[model samples]
Target: MKKLFIILILTGLIYVTYLNKEIFYKYPEAVRYTLKNSNELQRAEFEKVLKYFNKEEDNLKLKCAQVLISNIPLYSYKKEPETFNQVVDSIHALKNKLIIYSDSLKYNKRMLKKVQDLFVDKMNFLCKTNDFFDKEEVRDIDTLSSSFLIENINLAFEAHYKLPKKYRTNFNDFCNYVLPYRNDREPLEFQKRRELYEKYSWVYDSIKIKPLEDIVIQIYDDLKINIDFKKLSNLNLSPTPSQIEKLQYGLCRDVTNYFVLLFRSLGFAAGTDYITTYGNRHSPIGHNWFFIMYDDTFLPIQARSKSLIFSDIEKIFKLTNMPKVYRNVFNKINFKNSSINIDTDVTNMYRPTSTVQIENIFQTSNKEDFKLCVFNKKSNWFEVDKNFKLNNNKVTFNNVGRGIAYAVTNSFLEPINYPFYLDYKGNLMFLKNKNLKEDIPFNITRKYPPIDLPNKWKIDRIKALNNCKLQGSNYLDENSFKDIYTIKNFCSTQKSQFLFKKEEKYRYYRLIAEEVTSYTSYIAEFALINTDLEPIKNVKIDFYGTKESKLKQKSKITDNDPLTFGRFLNMKITFEVENNQNVSGFEIQARNDDNHINIGEEYELKVFDKAWKRVRKEKAKDTVLNYKSLAKDGLYILHNLTKGKEETVFTFDENGNQFWFGVSDVNDLGVGAPMSMGFK
Candidate 1:
């Protein structure tokens, strides 16, 4: 009898070992990766908690264990597992309730209530503990608790068990892509974290009874009409669900976070898709939106849309040049043999798009094909996108959807930092220009001719008139100017040219570097001109420098053109004429504040036409004709109704010939008057 009992015991031991092997092999890569990276303490704690469910009598628990073993890898632990002893104990005490809830046939309101009560009690106990409040890791304890762990485990079990047998092979998809609790950053902390979960569960339970397609539209409508949306600048930080309800407004990111959290809490797999920045010149900024799993495919959801599908959202954003769009996930990604540095904190939440370009700043000599890998979320990096041969230090990969990616050579794995977007034609474009600052010339002016000043300039007209008699030594202190009339401060540097106003004139001028520091002021060239801008010749000039400084004067004024100063003051009117069109003449009349013509204020718009002559003009009427009308009549009416500076353009069409031209401000246009023009 003793020999028979020993043989039975050995047979049982071998059977248990075989079952454990099957369980390990059944777990997917994402799950295994998450568990492998977890700290020793967390792994041990997870093992201890799961041990309670490893029983022969509880088939539900065994099945739940299989589902959980695969799903648990998606969770990222924030606290040391040993610190969750009280929470784990609380969950262990309710193992029977958990088993009952896991059983499809046994799961009912009574069993669910018992399970929920146990979870709530555990949460309350943990919240009151000093370890929970004092530890930095406990900041995310709501997500790290054993109760939450079971919630995810239960969700995974339901999704896998209830799924039709024909679709059981897709169990990994349902576990990984459907029933995860997290998408982006962890949901905002609630004072009663368990209560928040309960409310979300309630919402999920209420709507989950409806058809899958209806759920997304219903949730969108509820969020849009119920919440008072506000810009991100108004919120101090991400708000909890309870806070979001009270505040009634949030930035796009905040709203997206809320959307993702609410969906995940209810057993729906959801995440945020975002653009780091829009590289378009028109409106460049970052954007975020929610994407939920529906009908075995991920689709985008918008708060304002009643009928928009995922494809519609894609078209609205013009995803072709979006640069990079990332899908937020919960699990951390591992890069193997990385050659490029990565910000690990953000890598877990996002994955790359289908097409990507990898640019290497460093040159490598080995001629070999580089391996392109996508982050598995559950395991280390694995090659999914096809490998490419390096050409001109860059490799472009097609069909690489959004995720974290790396380029692996035999020596090391290099991260492809820049995310690429597909163009309208479905070609890859990168975010390389996101940080570039474009130089736009708003009111660009044509180059002006350099002005000239008289050579042999003299300083201190007052001192020279007084026959060099010093009234105060302070005037000669080098910090002081003897003649203030000649000095102008247009720029900080004393060497820049200064233009005199139309009426201002002086025969003797001085250019002195302000003596704030020991420096020499060099006079490159100087010239003096009359009212007609004819250069005044042979003026006496002298310069004074400090002991360490000397003025280096050029031998003759290079810019001696008499009209240079006049031309610099003159504004040139340019016409954007096409098809060899021409303007005969134009008349501009100044207007007074009372809308009456200022008689003498009239001028000819003939800067381009040397033989410009004034033409007839009239006060502007309330009715203004379109340019096409004037074009048909071979007459154009330009108006500068405002008393302030105004610019006007005239267009004309004679037969089939079209003429369009613009003039600079008709500074003299009478108030309410139209400046009329005729084409030649």
Candidate 2:
């Protein structure tokens, strides 16, 4: 009787195990590893997805599921309204209002300001309501539903198989590039990926018969019209496809993310490439763009531009200077130097690169490894490239971009030595101070490089100054003016001088605009100078212009503020000097970034020996700052003590021109001519 009872109990235990077979099923090693890290509920949800795929007999999609499941644990999204349905509706309402205002020429500045204020208020309200927008990272493994995962896998495979044979990528490539449900912090809502596919798939349909490049170009062109790229906050928020479609305002990274998702939605393999910092310290902010795969090769496209040919992209890179560039992939892989698991170095493929070797002064043994870093902020260094091993008392970093300042550091980012920069020819130039006792004369003009806009410098503002006349008159009448000087060429400098001897004593002087284009013109600051080349103080000035230009206060031309400009089609300014005998020349300042040194603003100068040491602190009495002699071959930085944060390190050339070390070393940045420093 006891043996029979034991047999019955064993049978009951076997039945219970068989009943829960699907729940305890095994997955691939990588997928199982992620599952092990997940909670019981998360594991059950993933198991349900696997069982559904297995029962359907969809082996291809089942493999894609494994790829996504293995990497999804690391991905998360912000629990914000950027992906919600209500946000899209709100954006559309605001966009409609914008369209109405933009369509009307009768709208005045007041009306425009009203619209802008409304937009700002709406955005602020939306941002403030969501504390989780930047505060929380909601993991997909914890929140993702089984149905969402299954559908994403199905749609990705469907799109991949739909592509033409020539444009189609291998399974591995598709899985790594196009199959991921989410990249970065994009939203992980149910049916979001499929919704994106359904919406943008039309862009591919009309151009399907065309070559892959043409179709890709058309898609980009259409998207650009629909999505408005803006210089929004540099918060690195990855806008969801829905947000991009509705709001149409995003930064470079946000736009790049949108482009990648749009391309992947239509069955094309696409990804993002970015730099955390530029080679030049003047513009420390980084940039990102999208790339598409064609014939086993990926081609990059600019984020805010129209579709560019492959050659155009290459040419842009040849002119661009970057310390490091990284590509984002779906696979759970990481470089030794980077903590990001999805990044791969692609700097060499974009620009001229070199292998860097430096003495391993900090290394205690051959087993020691180090990080190469770039200057980021005031005394801050950011790690880049790959982690290098120490060998033979030397550390080597490969595929380093040229024309950038670099330093060596441990994992904690503690610097081992003073920073050094790479020249355009891929040579290292050290920054150690050779003469600490001696000071150097420093003349600073701009704290930051002027913002580069296409056709802005040479074409719009400068070209408007062509044939502009400077005149002197003993009388206030315009007819009494005699031409002192006529600008024959574009004045490239923001602050330019037109000097001539005042042969005749003139009480009145006037600067007149000539050959102006319909393109809006502006004059920031204007001044009359004495024979000694000093500005005549307390001069009474008045402005006259065409009727259209009269709407604006033309007095802004002499406002003494570079940012406050008088916009005009045609205008003239007349000033009466108390004495005409001293009049010699006049000065003109164009509309600029206000980066030039301002009189009365305090400045601090520092040079790096072992660390940054203050050399002098004083207020600027002139447009330029003249200091004592500087230490030879030292790294120097100038800071605006009063305001602003865009200062950078620089050295002086033979002519005392500010040679921005990293900026000018790049070939086509058009900043300043490189100096022939006596370094090989």
Candidate 3:
């Protein structure tokens, strides 16, 4: 009788444990969505759970379950919706953390025992929590990995502040305080109070900017910091601190930091500011210098050089007013000595680099390669052959070779540190004319510890994929690497994905597809990306004009949604540009026509480089006009190309990607020169 009783107790414990695994993850999503105002919703959700558990009846449980299932939708209907989304996200993150924790429980005796305790604690308390969404509404990743992930709203800023004092302060001014609690602490408040004592007591009491002394040296003389720039450059290197102190030959950041440390030791507060170093690579290598605040004034301190100096803070801010980006910009703030190599893992920042900028660039002697080009922010030409004269912003090589050409402009010359993003929708949606930062998230599965009772799986949500083709296949699959968005399969479903890169610019592009797919019917959809900034009107586009086939027709990209569709074709589709500056990309969905598309994949053979002549002008390039360019915003009439439809507004897909072709446009940026391609 005793043995039987023990066996039954164990069985009951196993069943309860198996049934409650999903509850832990469901909570995190709710927490994430409510992060902005956790104080209000957190308690409400808890109360709901308390009420749910004590109802004590089958009818109550059924009613509660129904209520839970509807919670996610109800939150959607509420105002201040962004707050709710964060809750769901946080819950998802926690689930991943829990999973990691659980994995260790199996491998390491010490960690395993600790994890088991956590699971029991979590399970016991979670079921009692409120059912704001579904019984399993919050789960995201496994429970173990999110151990260090910060979920609360303050978590973002607080985590940043926790970095060593050096990193905390080295960040841009925007992240100085982390969570932007400075509505009342605007910088203009100081600028406005420059001279009044009685009217602004608080402002008067504030610490004012101070000045720093410049120690200049004669050309013949040298200080400890005055080292030669040449002595400290090469493949992956940095000058030692002893060298910096001994020679006083420091780069922008080194000199600035030396002065900052000096000021701090003198009982005064001083800090260094960084900016980008241009010309070495196409990317900007960040640089910084020191500043001191004293006697209600701020001044720049360049410890090594005497020729250039910043006299005041107000002036300094105006000179370097770069728009704050979401990623770390500090990586560029080094001097001749600071190194930002990926091997060092300084910032863990990885960006796609092109061979186009490789030194000893390939040159072509063949005159057939005549084409236009763009170099950094400048434009010029190169004489590739007797008749083929090409001009571009100054780079190397008076001649060129084929395959792919790499040209490094001033932008890539410097070391640039920024988060990667894909905004290829190309001005077609709310995200149109907008680029959002995208991080490659891990693919997830339902390896959650098996519960005794069977629980059905479901897709919580899904997002679309980008339609642009980057260098190599982007995703793990390699070929159709371009994906717009991703979601974890909480419940596995046997379905294939249609993948492509999102593009805003409209231009000539190609789709290379392999394999075949069979589905219920035959229909197709295509995404039209216009890289221009104007509205698109009626335009006729053709299909399957590959280097083969009967491919020509008409189509439109309506404002409502850019996913335009067409019938089946054995080959490719081609379209004309209208109502935009220029277009770079398009998408196609083929149904019913197995020859046109398969169930799983399609390839877009892209023509990345091309040349153009403004329709308004004869044969001259877009920016080099016959007369002065337009500075003020106005209509740019296309006088030539009388072949296409009479009234079509050609536009590209973004705010910055295209500027006026007119020379004197207010924004100095103009259309780019044509790129070289084809058999020379």
Candidate 4:
């Protein structure tokens, strides 16, 4: 009996080795690494997948299995809690119940709101539960099933071969971009690749006959129309593809993952490109977008319909000044100077980039590496490029995004020097304030970049006020109005100012629209100009012929808030000044984001040395702020201390115009305002 048992154990060992023969024979080192990192069950699962692929004698499928097995050790994933699906199911049930009750007039908006609040509360509680939180992380090597790998590989191969000749990519690109089963930290599920492929088959069929760019547009449009990009209340959940499909909503990252997976399901070589943090200090949140490899180019697609822009070159130029952009890949990239291996740096793919070498003045005894960091919110720095050992006390960083401020720091986060930025020509401009006693007068026109214009839907807003008239009148009657100035050309600016030789002492001024231009011919701020072409002081305005209340309406026209608007819908709007004051000209402003200096808001100015130091604080008494006695050649930030949050770091020219970092050839007044023209 002992001899028989020994023979049987030997036979089972031989069978197990035979099943895992391809991985062990072809990639012995990878097999050893995977087995060393995997537990007993995971080891068995890996063997099962290799055995299944080897038995079928499918060499391509076996190669795919080997790729996944070799790379599985580098990734980790989270398992969804049991209560997660239960909560989602319960929410759906409640929604159905509410809908049925509402059919009989049994539930009102308040009742629905109460239900939503209860659901949010429950999900929030689930997010904080310690038991589920602590057990969330699990290595993919330890949990991925053999069946899941087999189905994912089989479906990926099937969809890949179905692509047209022009769209078909190489095997290496296919393996990295199209064959990966997971793009995010979401859980892996069996048959997900097959399920998604079947669901998106129709999309592939419809666009297969078209060009590569059209294919991307079709996919983007489908996602934009069907899926809603929303942040779920369950903050802890890294939603899987199945969950995203059901919810039809997710954050930018989640939507990006879904978009890539949908393209990969149809055998397109697709992946995600992301910015870990924006380069501008005011833009705190990072962004992610989908991209597909076509003709050896990464074609970018926005996450949602919020922008509706899909051109690759345009998106790249528009999203310039990003600190760093990284592309997701399956195999770990062994960067020469850094330990980070998951994502590859693609910053140069977006814009003109440069290599910078800096002297490490803050070197310490430890001889730790230095990093290039971008400025974020208040006093925080995000590492953009890291792991540069000081070569003779000098470190070189590669592919640096120009037009953005960067601070070099040691491993201890100690700065090597004061903050500095690169110009468009790759010239370093240090953020050092010349501590002079001389007073330098400059105007502050905007708090942020003027790139905030209308999207595709309202693209004609700037040209809408082409024929509108700026008139002056001594009487309140409409017949008494005289045309002070007529806008003969298309309005090409956010704030258009005109001055004419006029000696008339008119008590009233009016902006009248004759032709219907757009959905609404709206003006954000109507400024009555004095003889010197400055905004008239203490001006009062009133509207006539419109039933809309005039109680707070005058402020809408004169408050200097670009977001608030006063429309002239076949109506008369008048700006009344003091009897002693005569209107010489007028300033017309189109609808815009409220980033300009407000009349009543207080502003704080600061300059950066080792840290931000207060320069001055003043209340805005006019549409423009005339700052006095500021240091020369200093990087400054203007903060609206009263209410607003958006602020950009800037420097001024000899002409007292603001120059924003990262934005090229742009000033405080004209960051290419027409919305028709791209960024200047």
Writing each residue's lDDT as its tens digit, candidate 2 over 205-309 gives 554666666766766665542223232462334456766665555677677777777778777888888888775565456778888886868778877644446
Off by over 4 Å in 3: 1-224, 227-236, 276-282, 295-297, 307-317, 325-680
Best by lDDT: 4
- RMSD, every candidate, angstroms: 26.1, 5.9, 31.7, 7.3
The residue-level lDDT of candidate 3 at 309 comes to 40
Task: Rank all candidate structures by their lDDT, best first, as comma-separated numbers.
Answer: 4, 2, 1, 3
Cα lDDT computed for each candidate against the true fold: 0.37, 0.67, 0.27, 0.70
Worst 10 residues of 1 by lDDT: 444-453
Model 4: lDDT of residue 572? 60
Q: lDDT per residue, candidate 3, 397-472, as tens digits?
A: 2222111112222222221111011111111111111233223221111111111101101111101111212122
What would the per-residue lDDT of candidate 1 be over residues 226-256, giving only the tens digit for each residue?
2223323322233445444433334566667
Error of 3 at 551 (Å): 64
Relative to the unseen true structure, what is the C-alpha lDDT of residue 14 in candidate 3, on a scale of 0 to 100? Answer: 88
Q: Model 3, residue 656: what's the lDDT?
A: 18
Cα error, candidate 3, residue 395 (Å): 36
| Candidate 4 ranges beyond 4 A from true positions | 1-27, 55-57, 76-135, 203-208, 225-237, 306-312, 315-319, 333-340, 362-366, 387-389, 435-440, 452-514, 520-593, 620-629, 664-680
